[model samples]
Target chain A: MQKKSRGGIFVISAPSGAGKTTICKKILSRNANIKQSVSFTTRKPRKGEKNGEDYYFVAQKTFQQMISRNEFIEWAEVHGNFYGTSRKKFEGLVSSGFDVILDIDTQGARQIRNSFSEGVFIFILPPSIKVLRERLQDRKSNTKKDMQRRLKRAAVEIKDYNMYDYVIVNDILGDSVKKLEAIITARRMSSDRVDPKWIKDNFLR
Target chain B: MQKKSRGGIFVISAPSGAGKTTICKKILSRNANIKQSVSFTTRKPRKGEKNGEDYYFVAQKTFQQMISRNEFIEWAEVHGNFYGTSRKKFEGLVSSGFDVILDIDTQGARQIRNSFSEGVFIFILPPSIKVLRERLQDRKSNTKKDMQRRLKRAAVEIKDYNMYDYVIVNDILGDSVKKLEAIITARRMSSDRVDPKWIKDNFLR
Candidate 1:
């Protein structure tokens, strides 16, 4: 985080196979002013994944205690595991002048919108349903039944694109990354984000 | 202009001596998607100025006829010279798939806001009142009295920056230009500016 820099939330949501993780990683690598928010989860870490960096892996008992203590910005249970974001950690990062990207689902995105109205919400989309289906079908790890179910879920989730401030169609990787970078650059200069003292001393004084 | 491409209007304004002309010029040179809206004026062209390129230099009679025919998106008179933007020419450029930038004054900007509510309106400000006075004085052409009057008027004009969607303080030329470009790029991806058919076909289909 840079001194006196204005930080805002960038809430990004995408369907199961939208390549949002790749886009987000690319954005983080290209820009020094932003970082991805590490989430807290009760699920065990996968191979080669660092405990804190991959996720704040904790026991179910600790996760439930945090939930009861109202320490999460938003949390959800999926596939018998608890996943959540810490209210203290998010505010600490943002208020200390770091733009944090939250890659969550539609439900968690909605919850953040209610809590932080000023956060910039962006929705990543696949180029087309045909393309999305093809990509899913190519993943041999998934069975035919699982692929079809995921495709149907993606269709319904994409209907919420209109709710976002910017929608980037992930048709081309390079182009999508540029658009994401542009939005961040443009947002940083927004009048509300700029220091009033700087404006007063430089422009009005 | 490209076939079926989305188009939008960007209304830019600044007080006198705010470096708006330079900013607008840089934006046009850097962006291929945007074009300046050439205005119609009854004033005679100065030496080395091209008629169509600088403005649609029209006779007073033609200007009045346009006013009577209601052919202007917004028009105003200053120093006995009438200036106006052609409604037909402006819309022709915009609807034909070109994003147009209108460099106008606060009065004209207000008129555009009323007529085209969706247009992006941005206000430019100088670093300081002292700097603005120096820039105006350095021009060497204006009398001391004229320079003082202009500065006073500028202070009042800049107070209306709140009416704009974005306010950029031109303290540094390179940074300001980059911010302007980002705003344009981000705005193009905004949901409202995109084609409904494109979204429906690509995402929903």
Candidate 2:
């Protein structure tokens, strides 16, 4: 029988410094069936970060226009920057049998889950609050006030982990990656996405 | 955030002549995390089938004793032979943190699914009735009457395809394995399995 065309979607959310981006990248690289869904962000690209690759860097005006046009599947405002995922791209990928992985914030993850009940949601956690803080501070990427703001947000974000389908405590990168890979492998074996159409076509013939 | 364990059981069933066994074996071999629970049967071993590997072959007397004690998770009669899965073994594997795959007939599969409402279930179908017959004939393992019996049973089995979580047609071995793999991967990624205990141990401290 020909392979089924239905694709799966997975959402990964974590605290800002929780290494979710790294894990998500590892997943996409390892999985042939999965592709990363780039978010359209109004925030300017950080130093050395490419525009289209890192984020679909869009203008504030363009982001607002897209929002008004119902182009975004989910959108969020983080630190004065507008970030959104394109609905068309996601729908296209899924319809064409491509499992899409979205690395988004808790709010955006929730929105996507509600909108797409079949989407797989994975929550990533730092080993500890202390470790999370230390990691954030070690980066020296933000001022003390910014770091404090992130810490407060992390506390709130941690509470939403219960809402996710799978949780990974990212204490070690390799172990977390293995767990993530396992999750992907297992989900593909799930019966929900396999349509009876294939069976009908195969057997009824 | 700690990872949750979506520890749902997956019951796979098909007629004797269907490609379910081969398909299941391929899936188990490729997916390391999924454990195929060996079932106990009172039936005499077929040619070249190993004990404890293909089945937990037991005497009829011992099988009846276990059934009387309610040791079976699920049990049913097929072709005058009794077959059952050990309840304790299933629980032990699950509690020990392994996701399980139960390869059984439709009746036993139904029993297990009913008992474990959270379990995942799937039905595998042959590409066609003709193909099923051909496969049985090719094996030359069954008597003429036995082959006819199996075909009849297959017809009855197909009726329950709608009752399963997923219906897969074993049209191609590799593709079917991929689809089955995806289902398991997605379920593991489900929100219910991602326990927050790891997060509690790490983050709370």
Candidate 3:
């Protein structure tokens, strides 16, 4: 019998209002073998957010201690709130042969790239800047000034699309989800991931 | 509008009895934009083979003259017959933005790899050597000696699977076809293949 191979890490990054969350959710719903990586955050959970399921809500002091001990594979502070992915958890899941999907910003993705070279990096883009502006405007959760700031941040983030292995223009939700799923399926069949011993045992003899 | 990008070359190589020819035919029938690259050969046409559709049949003298003129991308002498692919035709199809699939042996695939660095190489393997032997036995076209020779050749070719970008074990035809299709779809979304000008015009600006 062939030994099960280690799982793959798929990191997805997108600018605000690119519909990445929706695409990720759709992919997770369709694939039973893939699991989402829940991040550890110092920020308090909003209403209906479950611990360990949504985010592992940790005290600021505990987050700082974890950072000092070098427990994070990638971590960053946004709006003075600490957020990080645990190295132990990620490695454990991968070693157990469970593919993990991480939905993070470019900053966190960069850190992950530095620490783990095998991760597949994917970037999502809105169909156009005009579409992005309209989507942000429709949210109503942000003030005009905040919306403008988000648009500026998106412009900067979209420039980093070149760093990713795959790019998905989120013009339609279903199409983008299919593309994302294809990437995962194709990556699994990569020759580098196949076990040479298994090939030798089955085909050579 | 985005200028049409140059097309991609997909090369599939497999040992005998791996079902690669069937898979390639299915893929070509399903995809409207993909074309098969016909080879030029000095061998006589079989009962149902056509001149241009199956192969560009040529005299030994003409094949030698074309080789002297550097017209072929890759050529080889097999069983005292010359077979080659036209460099002009391959480049023309690619430059016209039509994806081309080349169903060739490992020798031709290696030659193409030396000439073109961008081609996607896929290696197909039968489920096991026992299965391969059974399938070759079922053909009954080959004598016992010829079948033995083919089995030996298959052993040598299967070792080259590591040189390919993707490896598909041909245990199930439908599953292997889906994996091959996924590879093509995912490659289209590769960030490196995306036009920078298009991104700048549509999303960045």
Ten residues in sequence with the least summed lDDT for candidate 2 chain B: B1-10
Tens-digit lDDT string for candidate 2 (B1-205) = 2132334588899877678888878877876777888999989999889998899999999999999999999999988998899988888777666778999888998888778987888888777778888999998668999887887787777767767877666778887787677667656655565555755565544
Each prediction's TM-score versus the true structure:
0.90, 0.81, 0.95
2 or 3: which has the higher lDDT? Answer: 3
- Please write out the lDDT profile of model 1 over residues A51-107, one tens digit for every residue: 878689999999999999999998876546788898888888888788889988777
After aligning candidate 2 to the native by TM-score, how far in Å is the CA of A46 from where it should be?
0.6
**lDDT agreement of model 1 with the native:** 0.82
Candidate 2 or 1, higher DockQ: 1
i-RMSD of all predictions: 2.0, 3.8, 1.0
User: Across residues B1-205, which tens digit of lDDT does each residue of candidate 1 receive?
Assistant: 0125547789998878889989998998988878999999999897767888879999999999999999999998754788899988898889877889998878788899998977988888887778888889887768988886787678667767767877788889999898888888888778665566676676676
Better of 1 and 2 by TM-score: 1
The regions of model 3 sitting more than 4 angstroms off are A1-3, B1-3
- The 0-to-1 C-alpha lDDT of every candidate, in the order given, reads 0.82, 0.80, 0.87
Interface RMSD (one decimal) of model 3: 1.0
Distance (Å) between predicted and true CA of B162, model 2? 4.8
Candidate 2 ranges with C-alpha deviation above 4 Å: A1-6, A30-33, A172-175, B1-8, B17-36, B48-69, B96-99, B122-131, B165-190
**Which docking category, incorrect, acceptable, medium or high, applies to candidate 1?**
medium
